[model samples]
Target: MAEALNNLVQLMDPYLLQILVNIGIAIILALGLNIITGITGQLSLGHAAFMSVGAFASAIITIRFNIPFGLNLLLSGLMAAIVGAAIGFPILRLTGDYLAICTLGFAEIVKVVFLNMDITNKALGLTVPTPKSPIPMPIYVWLVAIIAIIFSSFMKDSRFGRALKAIRDDEIAAEAMGINITRYKIESFALGAFMAGVGGGLYAHFINYINPSDFGFLKSVDMLSMVVLGGLGSIAGTVVGASILAAAPEFLRFMSEYRMLVYGGLLVFLMVFRPNGLLGGVNFTDLVLRSLGRKPAIAEVREKQT
Candidate 1:
């Protein structure tokens, strides 16, 4: 099955194949942000900082240490998680827009630090080594994206996920109910950073380039937008939102210079017309079944709305 998928992917137009891979990367990044800002209800604007860390770490490991491709990815994630834990404790104390601004500052700091660091090679950037694995990179990205989606979904149904949601809805009540708000917040931020790091590692290998400019504040905003526009805390919504947003530029290429204007307008329109997002608290599968006049596999996630 794997070989067949690779062969089929090989048959696709190279640009289209790249777009598919891009979507997978977007899914991973958006899901990571969803964990932090959506499920955990903690605003983060420095997610790209984690991604930058992973990208540079993976690139450095690949070039200097000559570690195997897979190890590089894992190490990058670990590196990002460590950094996340380092920053999360102090920063997670802030809530709402204040927290967002703090994270944003953190992101800018990371970018500037990377810009000055000799190990990161300053602005020149590092070139990722070519993969030695037989599996095509796009396939690896999709597989990892699938794993991330499953992990996120499982987290949502786990005890920890419930705690996070409780804190999100009402931190005081959650604390009163015996939830360790601080610990859960740190865990969510670190785990989300880890996922973003892994996604960055994949992107580094896929693009074969890394620079501080690539993972700046704007990149963080894009990931956050994917989560918010997909319906916070909704896994299916994240997937659909990532797909649409990631693919929009390619689809709008015919509009030339107006593409970006149209893109921004479209997002604004969606926000205005559907404040809850495309999926909101609703399950995509449930919505589909309802449209088909059949019972849905999973019930709607009405807790947030109710």
Candidate 2:
């Protein structure tokens, strides 16, 4: 058994390395969307627009100016955040369905602009300059994972995250409690966009090719699906959600044309059976404790009190 296990590990090492990198990128995308729809109660279909903006912006800067990859990523995310803030001012005033439609419109507009823009080569797409030396995928993946962990941890514990949650649960009550709803919502939305932009920048660099079609409504929906399937408000759940959705298609390639049908059907089944998702907003730490046969600390405390 030991020898077999060692052989399996040796065989799986390279694939595992690649999967880790992919998971890091997926986590960034999923967690970013979580801040928007999961935390702030905003439905945005324009996340892909923000991502495209970031991807193109980073690619252009890096290609033209020969900037460092890290700087390119940061600047791209900042630009996307600025755009998000600019658009948020007008469209965020709309609520629920109105908000959704406005964001959808925004995404479409961004797509059309990219399609027509001469700078982007008029829909032919632009080639991103590859790094001079190949950085092992695992290293980049670790960097992204660290960034994601820091961001998720900060947002999960910060006052900003709490305010956003309040807005999600009860907007009116949150406002009554003296929370600045508009500011918080806009901030959350922009932050989400910023993360999406960073993810896009990484994606562009990794793939070294992109087109307007890459960032569309379907992409936004896919991100949303990750957030929902992982458990709306859970960061860990988002990672799991993204992994399953992203990797499942590849694994099901043997089915070919029926793959998508199976995927969709599986999603429907999951929604029907577990509406709250796999982890239902719980974190990995909590899950680990439960798996170790420990009850929730709060529950134990309540029992003691009784």
Candidate 3:
């Protein structure tokens, strides 16, 4: 029994490591989507396009120019951010379904362009050259996770994030409060695109391949699902949502054929039962504090005495 237990532990080590990496990527993707759809209330269906742009850009730069991996990732993210901001100019004018359709069309257009672009192999796809003596997958995953956490933390408290929330709550009221709605919208779009790009770069390196087909409308839908499942405005919820959605299928391999159906059914059930999601609008920090039996500052004994 002890020998069997040791064997099981050995077998699980690698898979556990892989799951950690997947969790990091999922968190980055979910958090990025949340900024656009959750905070800014923009239903974008072209996020995969931005991700592809980053993936391809970083892959090409690393392969062709032999640039440092970090610089390549940064440049790729910046390129996607620029594209996102530029696209947001005209598309942001539309609202609701119209906006969604436009974003969907944008993703399709990007895919089509890549499909015909000879530089990207004209529908064949491109192989990313793996880094020489690359960092361990676990380390890379931790780095990305740290990056996502830092970005989320910064945005959660920033003026920009507040502006985004205002826009989401009521665009007209936000504008009335002297917020530059257009600027905030553009900023939100760009920020989301940037994160998506970083995630894409990580994905490309992790997979070591890229193709137009990988960034389809369905990919966008998956991202949207992450945001919705996590709770629209909750960062911690987004992380949980992404982790579960990403890992659920793998854990349910016995029901592989019915996976999509199960996912859809669960989504429907969740929306009907708890429209706000598991955590609703609660932030992760607040959730953790409450879990630890901590009270709000106003309710603390010291504060109350003061």
Candidate 4:
């Protein structure tokens, strides 16, 4: 299968191939943010900061220490996860808009730190080494994206995932039920940051460059938009959202200035008309049952359990 994919990738047009790669990267980003804000009910505006941590960490190692790409990627994710855990301890206490403000500030601080640090080339940005043509990178990107989706799906069904859902639904009730809110919150944040960092590592290698500005608040907003517009907790919706959002810029390039206007207007329309989101939710099973004019078994069981 691997050999076949390689051969197929080799035959594809470079531009088309790169577009697919970009979508895959965005999928990873969307999934990471989904884990943090969507599933965990945390409003973070500093996700890009975590990505920068991974990017810069990977860039520094690749440039200075000459580590292998895979190792550098793992090291970068570990670095970001450490930073996430460190930051999550204190900030996880805050909620809603307050948390968002703190995270936005955190992103600025990270940007400034990278801009001043000589290790990151001091705003000149770090250039990652890459092949003349996009090759193995696409495969790596999609592999990670697939793994991320699977991980998210499994997590959504795991014991910890239920804890997260309970917290999202009612934090006080979850705490009352003996769930360790603090531990889970911090762990979720760290885990989300880890995924973002891994995505960043992939971005760095694929783009062959790292700029502090690239992972600014704007990037965070874009990531958030993907999750929110998809439907907060729907992984399938996230994939669709990432695909459309990632592809929009190129598809809209013809309009230039008007492109953003159209994009913003579309988002506004979606928010007003379909506030829950695109797939903003009903599980596939529920949708199917409703379409067939039957009650969902899960809902029946839930009602009975309640």
> Across residues 1-306, which tens digit of lDDT does each residue of candidate 2 receive?
545544554566675656665667777878888888877889888889999999899888877887666777889899999999889988887789999999999999999999999888768998987754334434655577677866775676578788899999999999999999888888988888898888888888777898999999999999889889989888777878988987877778899999999999999999999899877768655565689999866678899999
lDDT of 1 by residue, 8-102 (tens): 87899999988999999999989999999999999999999999998898888888886677888899999999999999999899999999999
lDDT of 1: 0.90
How big is the positional error of residue 175 in model 3, measured in Å on the Cα after superposition?
Answer: 0.9
User: What does the lDDT come to for candidate 3?
Assistant: 0.83
All candidates: TM-score: 0.92, 0.88, 0.89, 0.90
lDDT, model 1, position 36: 92
Score candidate 2 by TM-score against the native: 0.88
Tens digits of per-residue lDDT for model 3, 248-274: 777767798998789789889988998
Q: Write the per-residue lDDT of candidate 4 for residues 44-130, one digit (tens) a residue.
A: 999999999998887777777765677777888889989998999999999999999988998899999999998898889999887
Candidate 1: C-alpha RMSD to true structure equals 3.4
Query: Which of the two, 2 or 4, has more TM-score?
Result: 4
Q: Residue 275 in model 3: shift from native, Å?
A: 1.0
TM-score of model 4 vs. true structure: 0.90
Query: Which candidate has the highest TM-score of all?
Result: 1
* Count of clashing pairs, candidate 3: 0
- Report clash pairs, candidate 4: none
